[model samples]
Target: MSETKTTVFRDLLAATKDGDWGKGESRQGHVPAYVIRGTDFAEVRRGCIAGVPIRYLAEKTVHRRLLRADDILIETAGGSRDRPTGRTVLISQEILDAFPGDVTCASFARFLRVDPVAASPRYVYWYLQYLYARGDMWTHQVQHTGVARFQFTRFAGTEEVPLPVRAEQDAIAAVLGALDDKIAVNERIATTADSMCDLIFQSRAQQHASVPMSRLLHPILGGTPDRKNESYWGGSVPWASAKDVVNATVGVLASTEEHITETATQNSRAKTLRPGSVVLTARGTVGAVARMVMPAAINQSCYAFEPGRMPAAVLFHMVRSAAKSMLGMAHGTVFSTVNMKTFDHVEIPNLPADVLNTLNGELASLHQLIVSHLQESRQLATLRDTLLPQLMSGRLRVKDAEKIAEEAT
Candidate 1:
């Protein structure tokens, strides 16, 4: 039997300096740097670019270091106690260039430099990813600490990584990288879908005179059941919040983080959200929007629009165009809240039925394309995840993997 070798990560890697990567200035004159935290990955993947300053980094302390193309960034803390810690991201040249100087990572994020001689950078990337696969380990580790967090000392010092021969590492990394390459292709398809939708919306909005959102559609407020009632949750109905609506790129709204019982649905102000309902975030996320492709339920934080005269697709277009101005309606000293009155005041240029239908058809087609790519990406991810541990631990042969991948196509 081959014996397992133990090694300290400190011995295997060098440390990072303060300037290795710095946070960008909060603001450039009146503009602010778009700082992306761990949770911002999806949004960043969306229309939000890396350096487009929504907020300024100028007032905050600015560091001078920059992240390298090959460096690995780990999020040491985030999310709930039951969730995992130490989310790692491989920094790329594109990300580095976009988020230039004063562009900094959080203090909790640690940068690691792997020795190329012992392990390939790509190999290290896959290996570190596999270690965090369980995710439960982090929850258990931080259980006693009260707050869930990824402490650098505990993570780097204690985690036992399976180190193999350099050649073996290269082979494993290659297989995983190929899978990622396919996923990237799918992502481009998703991007194209987004671009197509953007073109239609922009063209229509520019041609029509901007009006208050109220002229577009009828508003139906969502409601939440009493949480104290056990029957209020854990049923089949998807009880959506601002977070769910904001993430959806397609017309479909199938599920949510929480669910509600039939009894709860009957008791609360919550209504059965049908397919074609235009859901808009009224609180928390504020003006974010999504269209329901399936029957679901939404919480008080979001508003559902059931089209009266306009087709569901046309209403979606109108809502998307008015999102920015509608968000501005809500004002608060601490937290922002959007009332129905505010939504009633917003408007969109009314288009002829034929024109609205044409535009709606184009958008629906684009959304369908995006959803297809998204499904493909999900499948590729699942395959990569399934093979990750096997490849890393020598259970799967690289040659066999190549054959399987070829056959998959």
Candidate 2:
């Protein structure tokens, strides 16, 4: 790593206000189209729309500079450095075609105008993503709470970029790009799987009696101990809340963000949830569902419903099927919430025991297939990520990669 030559971000790029770019808000009348920008990167993700708003459109197309296929959108201020920073959507021809009237400019955002004379735009975009992910772009920077902010002006001002030869950049981007494409495909498959499950459950719900969650299973509430107590949250158990489960589509729990100390866990009222227990988010975008893969602690905003005389997968999907209804019933004085009674009265189909077992077996097989493809997609992604920087730097040769791919085939 010591041998790697490093370049500060500011020194390698320039923020050029192409006289053509127009702010999106001004597009009041011209066939409204829009793009969203928010603190959470996941907001732009396929299904998340809780707090994001798509407003207005490009005011003038002819006078304003249009973003081309390769242009990169950079968020300029207000985000935790480690998470999705101001950097955002990489424009593609397909995206431009999809939202022809939409474009974003200014208001604390800037476009990276690559010195095409010096580096390839694709190569630079990849480098920016790497910098964003590694948190190397912002090491020591001041963040003013309310004022327009930027860190390390050098990140936006530099003109000289270290770029691998064009051919190398193409090869590198291709490898990683292929992996991303596969991931996208897998996501579509997952969507299909979810749709199938929804159809199956909707049919069941319409034909079967409706019941609250509490009656079908025992409802357990979680508590958070005092953070000041060292022993409470320090334990190895994972403590989850509505925030933790909000948009999670799969897996028991993600080890990606936030953790509790055993001291905090012990001090708080949060209770431990068993691995197979169904987890339901009870407030603030309530009724999102997931199951714990391991024993973990949950916050009060989340409810752990342990299944009794029910198949785990069947119950999991059952709760998931009723998430919207559960959310609709929530009533709170200050914050909206699904009360325990909602779960207590939640109705589910009283399938014959044999039918329940059959459905469980069928779903188990389907889930296995979905998980397998997802795992393969992830593995391909890991391989692509491993090769990205090295390929970009010419540290690894394309010929060798081709050879490896051949051998794997």
Candidate 3:
């Protein structure tokens, strides 16, 4: 067994600093940098650094909060009803390289500089992830003004981490890092595939004058079963909500976090769509789009569209482009919602069948690649999630994890 000892969470860190929001635009004495918020933790982990707002900061603060490889960012605030605060993301050179300038955490996040002499930085990051996955971080969170805030000082001052010797830490980190690296590569592959489909759409479909997206695909509604009925939930039927599309790393949704029973589908209005149906979120998180890779039922919050006579990928990107164009139509004080009538204002290429069908084979191939990669990454993430706590708690050996990791990769 690997020898281990309990240590304060703060003791493993050489330093910790709160993040900054700085100025939203460039100004005298303000240097432009990427501000990483707690909201970005999910996207950043998936390797999509695009859309991260660049804030101009005082040069001195930028110097003080400059991020480095192996450093970790902890979310200090920004929790939701479904998700607690205290999420963490590890910084890597590849992520930093994605930005053209300096990178720093946002006001609601803080950076933890690991003490490499005490513990492997990657190992500490994996352990933090394990803790968050197991809901241990919720213990350190408190509500203030209806928002969840992580008690950083309290957590750092009191929480304990089981620490193994430096050598064992390195070994454990290596095993976990291998899994994440592969997952990251797969994510990149999936995103690139989707981008290729979009590029093809632009090149081939742009010449057409205009066609209302609604003319091609009709909106189909989804449903939710009674919450009080246990049999209605958690079955083989993949039940998708807006979050499933909003959080997808790639444009392909091969699986969902929640599933429903066939009984739920038959008893309720939740109609199941066949594979290749493109689902666009119509409420709350409106405009988020994904193509279903399997037969799935959706909730009322989403609208599913069949490919009809056109290619699935073609329809997917067309709907995505139109939804983005008509985003202003989705409006509400509480939850942003979209109506089918908004599509009349949204225009897409009116390309003829001869030109459109020519690109169908290639687009379908790319979509399939995206689906396969996403499905594979999902499985890899499952393996990592399963192994994380076992390895962190010293219940599973690094060598044993390495064997499983090797088999998965």
Candidate 4:
């Protein structure tokens, strides 16, 4: 093992700039650009940027703040008490390739450009992730007002970064990067499988009796556990709100931002949902549906349906189709308030056993493959997270870490 030195975090940065969110519409001096908010960091890290908002920015600002490959975007503002604000995402050419125009972080975030010779940019980004994971970034966050903010200047100038030599940095990054590359490959495959399953369901779900939506799903009512009681939250059970459902782009809800205790559910209206249940948002920005991959619960804004004796992929697309019809009715005569009675009036086609059963064999096999990829990605992610801090701190040698990762792979 070799000894490593430390450097002031800001010293490695060649440049840093605050971001801009200009007028929504095009101005004389402004051009259209995709704005990356703190919220988009997770998806952007995964190589998916579909939800990154588009906003116009002054041409000069865009030129000055334009994101390049290897830059790091930090969330300088907007975090809750539980989550710290110094969240960071590494920019890549792949992310830029997916976009049509230039990219910039929103006003709430800032971007850092590290001189590659001074520090490996990917290594620095992973160091920040390591910092956040182990509660080192929490001290940088302060809540004087409503939104918690990260003290960027102080954090950069005062904090010492564990600096390994360039060769060691690259070696460490390469070992971890291989795992991420696998995760990205899995994501793309699962996403394609999701698309194929949707097409299969749409093509086959026809010529059936139209029954009230309630009969098929028997919609389990979702309710919130009392928030003030600390015992009610942050347990093993995943809890889905409307936001969770809407954010699930591939029709699979693998995790949630919050969790509730099994005890909380037993004491409150929140019910524990069975695995393979299809969850749908019934109110507020409606019509998003996803199959819960694990045992979970939901808040009042969503409904959970156990996919009993049917392929959950079938229910996933069906509920989305039903939600669209229900939303259409709401737009016409019914108001925004959707309830059990609302589901009763709006009919959904019965799952014709023969047709869906035949389709079921195909869809179930495909859905299982997607879920398998997701599970593998998750396990790889856990291994990567475990290896990170030890590698960054020089506690785990890059060669030894590679051996562990090889075994996992």
Candidate 5:
């Protein structure tokens, strides 16, 4: 094994600074610039990074703070009990090319540019990911009030990291990066398939008759079993919330963070939705939709729709297309929310039986392809995650890890 040395986090960084805190007025007349938020950081995969459509700022002010290809982003604030603070991701050249516009992260995140002479940024990123997976990042977090904050200065000044030679770092990074690259390719394939399906559905929607959602589908509101009751939680039944729907990129929810007992389902309004039922977020993040791939109970924030005549695939898009209007219906001062009444009144395109069948036949294969890609990506991610700690800690050699990764891909 090559000799490895320990170094402080700050010594490896050329620069470290918090992102722009200014929430300037929207780019009404100015050029559009992308702004990364903490939520965006949370949404991305553990070792990957990408911007999300959350907020925009004036290009003039944000141009100075734009992220470079070598920069690393760390979530400084905002984390749940389950997900502790100090989540990190690496910005790559490919990401910069994808969004060519001026891009800067929001106030809740900090950016660190690694010193090329001192460390390989990709190696540092993978190490951070490994630390997070092992729950070591939590030891550097400080919880006050209710929010968990990453102790940036303390972490940077005192935290020790294993520093190998640059060549070894690059080799380790390459092994892990290969798995991520494959996952990225699969993600793009799934995204393209979904977009194609949506375009096809839009064209057919024009020829279909319109009917109120109440008439076309049966709506079942979700319920939460009392959190205080120990018996109500942790059973065989998978219980989904808005967060689960948000994470379900394929529009087919396969798993959830929390599970509920059968007794809880019977006691509450939460019903075990059958496979093919369309699940829609009716509160908080309105109109976020996913199809149930397995039997699961949903929380009060969601609505499960049993297809009357429409296929689940078509119904998923229908709700998705209506998301903007559904968001507009949200009425609350504390939190934006929509209810069953709003969905009941909303109208959706009603295709004839033959047309529905034909569309389903054409689109079903595309949907299946997407699901397959997502499943494959998940498996690859698991493998990459398993190898991360071993490679970083020198438990596995870079050449051996590379061979294993190549075979997996």
Candidate 6:
């Protein structure tokens, strides 16, 4: 590998602009727009940027400031105690197409358009991510009151980036982009499979008799482990909350953000739900559903449905189809919640034994395929992340990285 030249960030950009800060009223049947605050920066992983679907009405002026392909979106403000400011995502045509109309980030965000002759926007985006992973982004953050803000001027004017030739930059971006492309394709496959299963189940279920949920499954309400007890938290057991179920786009949840100790599960009302248990958000974010891919404990805000005679696959989609009804049952001033009575009153279609047996076999096969795709995506993501820093730093040649990336895909 040849030595890569370095240049200040300001020298590589053709333009830099902060987004519009104006607020818009929430009205019915308006144009959809996105803001930086809505971006799920926490869950964004290598090669995958989560799109914010929440839309608000914005003026035509705001639409003019919408993001373009190859532009880099940077989170300029807002930092948590654990994560500092300065996370960034590269805007691609695919991401732009996901939005119904023109998409733009909030005023708290900024866009950097690289000078085509000087640098590649994709390269700059990857380089910024490399800096973030190395904790260098924190050095460029300015503490204002309690909030951490990115020192955009100082960063743009002073922060140095290793610049490879344009061809090399393109090659690196292509190699990394391939892995991401594969991951995206796998995600689409899984989503399509889930939708197909839902359609199949719905068609068969319409002919069946409506039976009470109690007859199909036992709904076990969750309880909180003592938060103050240090021994109760942070164990190997996955502890799921309503947030986990709400954030999950897929039907199967393999893990959660928090976990609890065995002692905590034994002491509190929390119980370790079996792998096939159907978990749903019963309280705040009511009706969000997912199946437990592994044994896990749930928090008070969620409900775990233990499959009785019904297959887990059937119960999962049944709960999903009933989401609207569950939401209707939710009633609270501050937070919507569904109680035991809500579950007891709800009924699901009971398919014939022979029909159910055949459907269950088909659903099992479909779910297995989805799970396989999910696993492959995880592995591809790992490969991409591992190669990111090395490629950005010029320690690994693009050709060599391309070979590895292509093999992974």
Report each candidate's C-alpha RMSD, comma-separated, in the order given.
Answer: 4.3, 4.8, 2.0, 3.1, 2.8, 3.4
TM-score of every candidate relative to the true structure = 0.82, 0.78, 0.94, 0.89, 0.91, 0.87
Better of 5 and 6 by lDDT: 5
Ranking by lDDT: 3, 4, 5, 6, 1, 2
Q: Write the per-residue lDDT of candidate 2 for residues 1-409, one digit (tens) a residue.
A: 1123435455444444322223345444543434445443343323333343344544545324345666666776655644434465465565456553654443455556565545566667777666656565555345666443445355555523455556666665565555656665675576577567667756665766555555566778887777675556445777787877865555334331445765565556776666667788887867788766567778888878775577766777887876766666678867788876776655666666776687777666666656666666667657766766666556777777655544432
Error of 1 at 243 (Å): 1.7
Q: Whose lDDT is greatest here?
A: 3
How many collisions per candidate?
Answer: 27, 44, 0, 0, 0, 1
lDDT of 1 by residue, 1-409 (tens): 0233545655556555321122344335332333445665443333234423333433434333234676666666564644576666666565567564434454545567677765577777777788778563464245455555666676567666666666777777788877776776676677667767877777875776655666656788989899898878899888888888877744345457888887887888887777778888887778887777667888888888886677776677677667777776786657787887886677778677777778888777777776677677677778888888777777887787777665543
The true-structure Cα RMSD of candidate 2 reads 4.8
Q: Quote model 3's TM-score.
A: 0.94
Across 1-409, the per-residue lDDT of candidate 5 in tens digits comes to 3889989989999877787755455556455556677777644543234546435555466666778997888999888878888888778877766664766777889888999889899999988888889998787889876778888898888889898888999999898988988988888788889989999988998877777767777778899999999999999899999999988875768889999999998999887888877888877766788888789999999888875577777777777776656776676767777776776767778888888888887788898899889898889999998999889888999989988998988
Any residue pairs clashing in model 6, and if so which?
36-106
Q: Write the per-residue lDDT of candidate 3 for residues 1-409, one digit (tens) a residue.
A: 3567888988988989999999987799888989998888878887889868999889865799999999999999988887889899999998999888899999999999999888889888988899899998889999969778999999998988888888888888898888888998998998888888889888877777887877776889898998889999999999999999887667777778899998898899887889889899998778999888889999999988887777777888888888878687776768888887777767888867886687777788888888788878889999999999888877898889999999999
Candidate 1 at 143: error in angstroms?
Answer: 9.4
Instruction: Output the lDDT of residue 42, model 6.
Output: 36
| lDDT of the candidates, in the order given | 0.67, 0.60, 0.86, 0.85, 0.81, 0.79
> Residue 328's C-alpha lDDT in candidate 5?
68
Candidate 5: clashing residue pairs, number: 0
Off by over 4 Å in 4: 206-212, 224-249, 254-268, 283-285, 309-311, 326-337, 345-347
Local accuracy of candidate 6 as per-residue lDDT tens digits, 1-409: 3657889999988877887654465665556566544256433333234455445655556656677888887888887777878888777887666655666667778888888788888888888888888888888888868878989998888998887777888888888878878887887788889989998999898988887666676779888898899999999889999988887657778778999999998999888988878888977777899988899999889888876677878878888877767787776878888777776777888787788788888888898888889889889988988999888766787888988887787
Model 1 ranges with Cα > 4 A deviation: 1-6, 17-36, 41-64, 97-104, 136-148, 209-211, 249-255, 393-395, 400-409
* Candidate 4 residue-wise lDDT at 308: 73
Candidate 3 vs candidate 6: which has greater TM-score? 3
Q: Name the lDDT of candidate 4.
A: 0.85
